[model samples]
Target: MTVDLERAAPAAPPAPPRRESRIWLVATAVTAVTVLLIVYPLGRTVLGVFGIGADSTVGRIGEVLTSGETWRLALNTVIAVSVGSVVALMIGAVFAWINERTDARMGFAARMLPLMPMFVPSIASAIGWVFLASPKAGVLNGWLRDVGGWFGLEMVEGPLNIYSWPGLIFAYVLFLTPYAYLTISSGLQSLDPALEEASRDAGAGALATFRRITLPSLRPALGASVLVTVTMGVAIFSIPLVIGTPADIDVLPVRIVHMMTHSYPGDIGGALGLSLLVVAAVGGCWLVQRRMLAANAHATITGRSSAEAAVTLGRWKWVARSAMLLFLLLTSVLPLAGLVLVSLQGFWSAEVRWGHLTFDNYRYLVDNELVWAGLRNSLVLAVVCASVAMAVGVLVTLVLARRRGRVASTVDAIVKVPSTLTHIVVALSFIVAFAGPPFDLAGTYLLLAMAYVVLYVPQATFYATAAYHQVGPQLSEASAVSGAGDGTTVRRILLPLMAPGLIAGWSLVFVLMTGDITASSMLAGTHTPVVGFVILDMWTAAGYPKLAALGVLMTLVSSAVVLLVMTLRDKLLVVR
Candidate 1:
C-alpha cells in the first residue's frame, strides 16, 4: 500500500507540469499569430507613413492637409453619414416601437420581415436599387413620368436619380434601419411594463407616457443604435462605390480606392494616411459610445417583471400595419424584384417587353471560365477562412479563460483591436505590409484569405467566449482529478460542450466572408477572382444584366450555406 501511494503521488506531480506546458504552448501560439496578422501589418502601414527625402511622408501629409479635394471628400462623407443615420434612427425606432410595444397586426411577421433585408448583401441591394431608380432608365421613374403626363404635366425623363446624394442616403438608411430596429426592439422588450401602466393609470396620454417614460427607458439603446448606424455609414464601401461613383460624388472610401488603383503610380502613401485619419475618427466615436454606456447604467427593469403587456393601438393598428408593409416593400421586396427583372432584360431600360427578354446573361455567367473560377474561389475562401478562424478562436478562448495576468489582458485587447477598425483600413494595411519584400503575397488568394481571417477572428472569439462561459470549470477540474491530461480533457469534455458555439461562429464568419466586398475589391487580381470583384467589374463595364444575374447567384449560394449551417447547429444542440 505504501509503495502504491508513493507511485500515485509521483504521477500527480508530472500531470501539473504537462498541463502547464500545454497552456504555455497554446498562449504563445495565439500571441504569435495575433502579432503576425494584426500587429505586424498595422505597424508596417504606420511606419510607411514617415518616409524620407522628396517623397517625404511629412510632405505627403502636408499635401493631403492642403488639398481641397481631401476636405471636400471628408465633408461629403460626413453629410451622407449624418443624413443616413438620422433617417435610419427614425425608421428603426418606429418599427421597434410598433413591433414590441403596440398591438399591431401580424406582429410576428413585422418583426421577421425586416431581417430579410439584412440577408441580402449591401452590394446586391445597391445593384437592385440602381435598376429600380437609376435616372436614365429606371422603371419606376419612367412609370412616374407616364403617370404625370396623363395629368398634362410635362415631367422630366427620369426624376428619381439614384446616383445623387439623396439616392445614396436612401440606400444607406435602408441598409442601416434593420440594425437600429434590432437594437431598440431588444431594449423595449426588456422594459418593465409596470412603469408605463402606472403612467397610463395617472391619466397620462400615450404620447406623454412615451416621452416621459418609454423613450427615457430606451435612451441607452437609442444612443448605441445611433453610434452603430453612424459608424457604419462612415465605413460603408459598396453602396458609396456603386452609387457615388456614377454621380461623380466621391466619399472617403471611394476616394481611397481611386487613389490606390487609378492614380499614376498609385498614391498608396496618401491612401494610407487617409485611412489612419478614418480609423482615428472611428475610434473617437467608439470611445464616446463606451463612455455614454458606462455613464448611463441605471436599471429600468427589475428581475421580477413578467411578460410585457402590449399597448392596444385600437383604430390606429391598421395604419401601423400599413406603414410596416410599406417599409418592407420599399426596402426588401422592391429591390429584390427589380434585380430579378433586370436580370431577364437584354438591357436595363424603362420599357419592359417580354419579347426582348433572354437567358443570355445567365448563360454567359455559366459558360464563362473566369466566372466559374471566381465562384470556386469565393466558396473556398469562405469555407477555409471560417474553419481556420474557428480553430484559432478555440485557442484564443482557452488562453483567455485560463490566464488573468497583464500579458493575457494585453493579448485580449490586441485581438479585439481589429474589430474596431473598418474593413477598408484593414485591407489597406495588408496591402502596405504584405504586398512587397519578404512577403510579396498581393493579388493572391492566400493574401485574400488572410485578410478575411484577420477581419473575422475577433467575431468568432466573441462567440466562443460566450459559449465557454456557459460551461462550468467543475468539469475540467473533475477531469484533472481523474488523471486525464489537459489535451485529453479538452477533447473529451470542453470540445463536445462547445461544439454548438463553434458551429455558430463558423456559420456567421462564413456568411460574412462570402458576402464581403471591401477586402475582395482591394486584394483580388485577374488571377485571383472573387464574386464581389467580378460584380464590381461588371458594374463598371455597364453590364447590368450580368451583374444582376451574378448577384442573384451569390445570394442563393450564401443563403443555402447559411441554412445548412443553421440546421447543423440545431442538430448539434439537440444531440448535446
Candidate 2:
C-alpha cells in the first residue's frame, strides 16, 4: 500500500504556458484598423446609396436612378473612358514595340521616358495643358491661329478648346499612357522572341508576324493595360474638375462632387447612388479582365530567354526615335515647361514674351500665408500618411506571407477594396461614417491623413508583398526556432530585407498624396488646408498664376523627395 501511494503521488509534469503568436496579434490589429478605416466607411456609403443611413433620404436614390441627367453623366463617363483608354493603348503599344523590339536611337532614354510623367501631378498637368490649350488664351492655340492667319485661313479665335470633350480625352491619354507603357513594356520584355524569329525565318514580314504572333502573344498584357487605362480614366477626378467644370460638362465624378458639395443641403444619397454606378462600371471591367486573363493561360514564354536579335528597323529607326521623343515631349516635358512658364508670367495670356514673364507669381506664393500653411500641412500629411501606410502594409504583408489561412487572404482583399473606389467616393464614405457623433473627425487634418492612408494602403501592400516574396521564408522560420518572437524577427530580419520596398512605397505614396486633389477637395476645408485644396481654390478663384506657381513648387518638392528616396533605395539594396 505504501509503494502504491508513492507511485500515485509521483510528480505531475509541469504544464507549459500558452503563448499567442505575434503574427496573429499583428494581423488582428491590422484587420481592425482596415475595417474601421476602409470597410466601415465604404459600408456607410453603400448604405447611403440605398437611402438607409443617417445622411440619406428616402426615394433620393430612386430619383437619381431614374434621372435623365444621371444617364447622360454615365454616357459621358463611358465615352471619356473609352476614347482615352483607346488612345493610351495605341500610344503605349507603339512605344513598347518600338523600344523593346527596334534599335531606336536613345533606346535607354525612351525606356525611361514613360516614368517621367509620374513626377508631374495630374492636376498640375491639367493646369499646364489648360494654359497651352484654353480657347481664350492658349499659347499653342495662339501660335496655331497665327500660322493659320499666314495661310489666309480664317481660323477660329481659339481653334483648340481644352474645355471640351476632346481636350479631356487628350489630357487623360497623356496621364494614362504611362501606366499602359509600364505594363505593356514589362510584358514585352518578358516575351519570348523565338516565335517572332521563326516566323521571320519562314518569310513572314514584320507586320505579319506582329499581327499573327506578337500581338496575340501580348493579348493578355494588352487587355490588362486597357483595363487599367479605362479604370483610371473612369476614376480620375482632377482632370475632369479642371477641364470639364469650366465647360459645364458633367461627368460622373464631377457630378458626384457637385451633388455632395453644391446641391442644396448636400444630396449625400444621390452622390452615393452615383458612386454605385461608378463602382459597378469599374467592377464589371475588373471582372471581365479577370475572366479574360484566367480563361487564356498564354504561357508562351518562361523565365529562360534564348539569344534573339533585336528587330532591324533600319531607316525607320530614326522615325521610331522621333516618335518616342515627341511622345515624351508632349506628355511630360511640355506640360512641365508650360507650368514653369505660366508660373513665371506676370499674367497668364496667350503671349509668351519677356515683358509678360516675371517672377511675381512665385514671389506671391512665397508671400501668401495660405500657401505656406498648405505646404506645411501637405508635408506633414505626406510624411505621416506614408509612414503609417508602409508600417501597416508591412505588418499585413507579414501576416499574408507567414499565416496559412483564409483569414489572411480575406484581410488582404479587404485592404485592396478601397483601391477600386474612386478617391472622391472614399472621401465621401469617410465623411458619412466619421463626420458625426462617435469618432467625429470632420474638417481635421487627421481625417485627411486617414483618407490618404486608406487610399494608398493597397499600393504599399503590393510593394511590400513583392518584397516579402523575395525574402526566403526559411530565414523567418529559423529566426522563430532561435527563440526570436515574430516581432523581433520582423524588426531584425524582415525589416532589413523589406527596406527597399518600404522606402519605395513611402516615396510613391508621399508623391501621390502631396498632389492628390480628389480626396483633398472632398475632405479638406479652411481648418485643414492642403496643397491640393489650395491649388483648387486658386484655380476656382481664377488665380491661374498662383496656381501655376504652386504647381511648380509641388513638382520641385516631389522631384527632390523622389530623387532622395531612389538614392536611399539603391543604398539599401546595396547594403542588403
Candidate 3:
C-alpha cells in the first residue's frame, strides 16, 4: 500500500491562454495617472527653474546664487537653523535620556508632552509663543509688570520684543524638539540593556558607564537626530514667517516669497532661480545623510518592542525625574498656558492688568471675518490634502513594495526632496511650474493640495512600505490560492493591516499642512486665506489680540480633531 500510493494520480499542467486586454488597459491607466501627478509637476518645475522659455528664466538661477542679498539671507537662514537645531537636539536628547534612565511615574507623560508640539501646527505654536512672550502686552510681561509695579521695579519696558531671533528659536524648538525625541527615543529603545549592566559590573562608574557604554552606543541615533533637526530646522518657514517677520528678519525662504510676490512685475525668474539654488543646497545635505545611512555597516533594528532599556538612576533618580518633568512643563504646558491667557484678553498688548482680561477675545473670534475664513480654509485644505496624500501614499507604497530595489531607493530620495527644501522653495517651484507652463495650477486649492501631497508623501510612503514589508507575501499568496483577485486581496487584506501606519502618516501630514504658512502664502487665493496666512496678516496688521484669539481657536480645533482620530484608530483600526 505504501509503495504504490503515488501512482494513482497525476497532476494537470497549468494552461496558457489568452491574456486580458483589461489588465494592460488598467496598467496603462495607472501609469498615465502616475506620470501626470508625480512626474509632470516635478519635470515642469525643473525646466522652469532652468529658464526653458523665451523669457530665459535659467540665467536667474546663476544670478540668484551670485547676489549679495541672497547670500545674507542664506547666512541668516543657516544661523537660525543651526542654533535652533542645536537647542532642539540638546533638549530632546536630555529628555529622552531621562525618560530612559529614570524610574518615575511622570516618565510616560514626559515623553508624551514632547510629542504635544508635533500635534499642533507650527503657525499655532508661533501665535501661542507671541501671546506669552510679546514685549509690550505679553501675558508674562503683564504678570511681571503688575508685580514690579507693587515693588516699584520697571518690568515692562517700551516694548518687550520676543519677536526677534530668540523668539523664532523658542518657537522652532517648541515645535521640533518632539521630532528629535521620538526618533532618538526609538534608537535608545533598540540598544541592548545588558551592555549597560555589563559596564557597571566591570567596576565602571555610572558617569563613566554612560559616557563610554551608553553615549557611544547611541551615536547612530545622535547623528540621525542632528541630521533630522538641522534639515527640518533649515527648511522650516512657518515659524520664521510668524515670529521672525515682525522683526524684519528675512530668511532665505521669506526673501524668495517677497521677491516673487511684491517685487516689480513679479520677479518670478529670480524667485525660481533662488529656489532652485536653495533646494540644491538643502537637498544636498539630506542626500549626504541618506548616503551615510545607506553606507552603514551595522544593521539597525526596528520592530514592535515588548521590552525597553531602563537604567537605574540610583542617587540621581529623583533629580533626573524632576528635571524631566520640569522640562516638559516648561516646553508644553507653559506655551499652551500663554495662549490661554491671551485668548481671554480683550487687548493682549495695550493693557497690562487682569481687569482688562475678558472672554471678549474668544467671543470676537467666533464673529471675526478673518478668523472664520482662515479656520474654514485651514480645515478644508487639511482634509483635502490629507486625503490626496493618503491616496498617493497607497499607490507609491504598492510600487515600492512590489518592486523593492532601485525603484524604492530612487523614490525614497526624490519624495523626500521637498521636506529638505524650505516650503518657500516648493511654493516658488510650483509657481514656476504651473503659473504659465503647459500645466498651470496656480491660484487654486488644487495647487495647495498637490503641494501638500508632495510635501507629505515621503512620510506616508516610508511608513506604508514598512507596514507592507512587515505583512510579507505569504498572506497575499494565501488569498490568491483562495481565488481572491489582486485588487480584492489588496483592498480586503493589505489596506486593513496598514491602518495604523496610514493613520500615523496622515496625522503627520495633517499637522504640517494645518500649520503651513510659506506655501499657503503663495497659493492661497482671495477666497481661501488659510489660518497660517491669516495669522501672518493679523500679526503684520498689529492685531496682536486678534492673532492670539485665532491661535486659541485653531489650537482647540486641532487638539479636538487629533484626539478624535486617535480614539477612532484605537477602537476601529487596531492593527497594532
Candidate 4:
C-alpha cells in the first residue's frame, strides 16, 4: 500500500505542476497580449471621450451629450440600419425559402451566387453598382439609350444617379441580403418538416402553415439575422465612404472616419470621444441580442452527419426556382458579370468595342508599384495576422471552456470588448494610446497584426466557444486523470476533438480579415497596405480595371482558402 501510494503521489505533483503551469502560462500570455492590443486601445478611446488624460480638449462631455447633431446622426444611423435590416431579411428569407422548399436545379447556384460579394471586396461592389447606376456615364443608361434609339424614341442622356439615401439603401441591400440569406437558409434547413406536415394535415393551407408554423419556428434565426444585419449596417464604412462621401451624405461610421481624418490639427481626442458614443450604442445592441437569444432553444432536426431534408413546394416549385434565380442574377451573376465586362472594356463612358479588348488592365496591375506592393503586403499581413488571431482564439477557447475561475471569466469579457466598438473608434484609441508610450507599436507589422487580432477575436471566440461547448470536458479530464499531462492531453485529445471548431474559427477569421476594410483603413497607417486599402486607392484613382482585377483576385484567394479549410476539417474532425 505504501509503495502504490508513493508511485501515485509522484505522478500527481510532477504531472499537475508542469501541465497546470503551462496552461496558465499560455492563458496569461494570450490574455496579456489581447489586453494590450484591444483593451488598451479601447481604454484610451473611452478616456478621450471625457477629455481625460493627455491632450485633453476644452469641451465637456455634457456638451456632446446635448449636441443636436449627435442625436440627428444617431437617428440617421438607426433609420439606415432599420431599413437595410428589414429589406435584407425579406430578401434572405424569400431566397432561403426557395432554396430549402423547391427542387430547383439552380439551388446550388442560388447558394453559390450570394457568395460572390464575399469574394469581391466591398469597394469593388460599390464601384460596380456605381458604374451600373451612375447618372452621367452608367452603362445601363447607355444601353437604354441605344435600345431606345433603335425604335426612334428620344433617348435619355444623363446618368441614373444612385447617390442619396435610396441609392445607399440599394447598395446595402445588395451586400447585406447575403447575410440574411445564409442565416435564414441554415434555419430553413434545420427546421423539422413534421411540424409543417402536421399543420397541413390539420386542414391548414400552405400560407397558413407557413405563417403559423414555419415562421415561428425560425424566429431565433430570423432575429439573429436582423440583429447582425442591423449592427453591420450601422457600422458600414466602405459603402458610405465610397458612395455617400461623393454625394455629401453623412452617416455615423462615415462621420466618425471624417472626424478622425479631416478634423483640424487631427483631433484624435475628439474623434475617439465620438467613437466611444458609437461603441456604447453598438454594445447596447449586442447585449440586447444576447439577452433575447439566451433563453431560446436552438435544437436542430439533424446532427452533423445528417443531411437537411428538402421541403416539397409541389405546385409552387417553379415560382420558388424563379425567385432564387432572380436573386442570384441581381446579387451575384449580374454584378460580377458587369464587373468583368466593364474591366475588359476600355471605357465606362463609351460604348463597348469588342476590338478594344486588351490585356492592358492585367499588365497595368502587374506593373504598378502601389498595386503590387499592396497585394504583397496584404498577403503577408493576412497570413501573419490570421495565424496570430487563430492562436489567440485557441487559448481563449481553452480558458473559457476548461477554466471556471473568476480570472478566466474576466479574460473572456475583455476579449469581447473589441467587437462592441467600431473600427474608427479603435483606430482613434490606438493613435492616442501608442503615440507617446514606452510600448508604442505604431506603423509596424506588429500593430497591424494586433489590430487584426482584436478585430476578429470576437468572431473567433463566438464560434470556438460554441465548438468547445459541443465538445464535453469529460474527455480532457479523463485524459488528465489517466496520467496524461495537459500538453499531451490537449495534443492527443482536445485539439483533435475540437478540430472542426478550430478550422471553422480559422476560416471565419480568414474571410473577415481578408476583406476587412474599416479597421484596416484606420490601422494600416503606412507600413501595411492591406487589400482593402488598395481597393480604396484604386477606386479613388479611377483605376477601375485594376481595382476590379484586384477584387477578383481577393475573392478567389479567400474562397479557395475557406474551401481548403472546410475540406481538412471534414477529414479530420468528423467522428466516424
Query: What is residue 343's positional error in candidate 1, in angstroms?
Result: 1.1
Model 2 bad stretches (over 4 Å): 1-24, 51-58, 105-108, 147-156, 195-205, 208-219, 298-303, 306-309, 477-485
Ranking 3 against 4 by TM-score, winner: 3
Task: List where candidate 4 sits over 4 angstroms from the true fold.
Answer: 1-24, 55-75, 98-116, 151-153, 157-160, 184-193, 206-219, 263-265, 280-284, 287-310, 405-407, 469-482, 563-576
Q: RMSD to native for every prediction? A: 5.1, 4.8, 4.2, 5.1
Models sorted by lDDT, best on top: 2, 1, 4, 3
The count of residue-pair clashes in candidate 3 stands at: 4
Cα lDDT over the full model 4: 0.70
Candidate topping lDDT? 2
**True-structure lDDT of candidate 2:** 0.81
TM-scores for the candidates: 0.87, 0.90, 0.86, 0.84
Ranking of predictions according to TM-score: 2, 1, 3, 4
Q: Give model 2's clash tally.
A: 0
lDDT for predicted candidate 3 compared with the true structure = 0.70
Per-residue alpha-carbon lDDT of candidate 4 for residues 230-297, written as tens digits (9 for 90 to 100): 66676678888777777766777877666655554465544554565676667676766676577566
Residue-by-residue lDDT tens digits, candidate 2, 1-576: 345434456788899996768666867687578767788888766766656757664477777888998999999889888888888888888888877776673655777787678778888888889988889788888788888989997766689899998898898888899889988987787788777888899999988999998887787887678667776787788898889888777799888887766654567778877877888887887887787677667786553343345787889888988887787788777778888887888788887896657888888888888889999899889988988888888878776775667876778789988776677678888988887779888788888988899999988888888788878798889998999988888889988997887787788788888988878877888878998888877877846877888888988998898889889999988877
